[model samples]
Target: MTTGTARTVKVLVADDHPVVLDGVTLALQRTSWLDVVGYARTGRDAIAAAARLQPDIVLLDLRMPDMLGPETTAGLLAGTPSLKVILFTAYPDHAAVEAALAAGAHGVVVKDVERADLVDAIRKVVNGERGVTAGIETDAGAVTARHGLGGRGITRREYDILRRVAMGQTNPEIADALGLTRNTVKTYLQRLMEKLGARNRVEALARAHELGLL
Candidate 1:
């Protein structure tokens, strides 16, 4: 005996490009086991649709006018409590890929792939398989340490913040966990940014990975 979910997958299509959205939506709609629950043309809209639809998978584009893929990914995970997202990108940089996975995107598809890869990626994510990009170790922290991604000598508290942020914990959660005020957490985040040469939390996380502190 097995669950019906083993056969069917529900999908949400989100992209800044109308043509890509329409194409993916139409392609998925053709399958008996797949349904296109909603289409979104912006990161904010994607979060809204995913929250309402609670689809099994979300096809997310990286470059949106309103938000980049990393921020959009964080928004999706923040908004939709039950949806899994798969990043869709023309560029597959290690930084972007790592950010997406840390932000809870289950997989990534380069834009040039044939439609079949998209369909199959949806199925894989629905089956509770994290479709990781090749060569990334699951142990981001250990990898980071081994590679000496540490810089400017992060303090223990900063280390705590970096670890939590890399694990996808928001500032509020980090604050609560560390028994610090949210403002304090924000300050620590800023300190980490300057020390690591990162522009923001996402950049910091990626930089950590690059230096092997991930």
Candidate 2:
């Protein structure tokens, strides 16, 4: 929560999708604590909007057609020194996550996040706390272990597969559930097993659970 004297968090939302932009803007508008100051559909527009609006936070999408991933995050931050940025994404890759942290983003939130959580993240960022919405863990050290930033991190997809495996789902079952081919599941399993230094699925699950990756 913000101090009583503090102004509402002025927000600039940047996403190429109109529906997403409208939904986010409307949700923020519904909250008295947040003020939707502007909207941008591209990274260039976002940077311009940040400079013009001087917003307290920028709700950004990781994959913009014009400017992709961490580069957009870095650009926005560099241009607006006081701006706090929260990445909104469905596909959170390890490299992008590391780059975002390194570039001083305040948070990384998935796109399907609840409105309350989104509001909380905005408030947290405004108050100088790192905002991490659901599914994505906040432990930087743990993240480092998983995502070494050189194609080393156990990806979100891998973690998903591991969770399914922990539930005793066979490769075929997991494939059906995740909309992946069995061969693809097997490949991911093999790669994750190597990453975890596990001999097999059982050991992999054990290692993942121990590391809090499940």
Off by over 4 Å in 2: 1-5, 137-214
Best by TM-score: 2
Residue 71 shift from truth in candidate 2, angstroms: 1.5
Worst 10 residues of 1 by lDDT: 132-141
Candidate 1 per-residue C-alpha lDDT over 1-214 given as tens digits, one digit per residue, 9 for 90 to 100: 1224655666778888888977877777777788787888888898888888888778888666565565678888888757888888765553345555666778777777766766766666776778543223343334334433333577657866786786668989989978999999999999999998999988997987676444
lDDT of 2 by residue, 1-214 (tens): 4524457678999999999988898878878878898999887899889999999889888767665545577778788888988888775544455556666777777778788778877777777787455446564435644554234467757766765686578999999978999999999999999999999988987876565443
* Backbone clashes in model 2, listed as residue pairs: 146-153, 147-153
Per-model TM-score, in order, reads 0.61, 0.64
Cα deviation at 141, candidate 2, in Å, is: 7.1
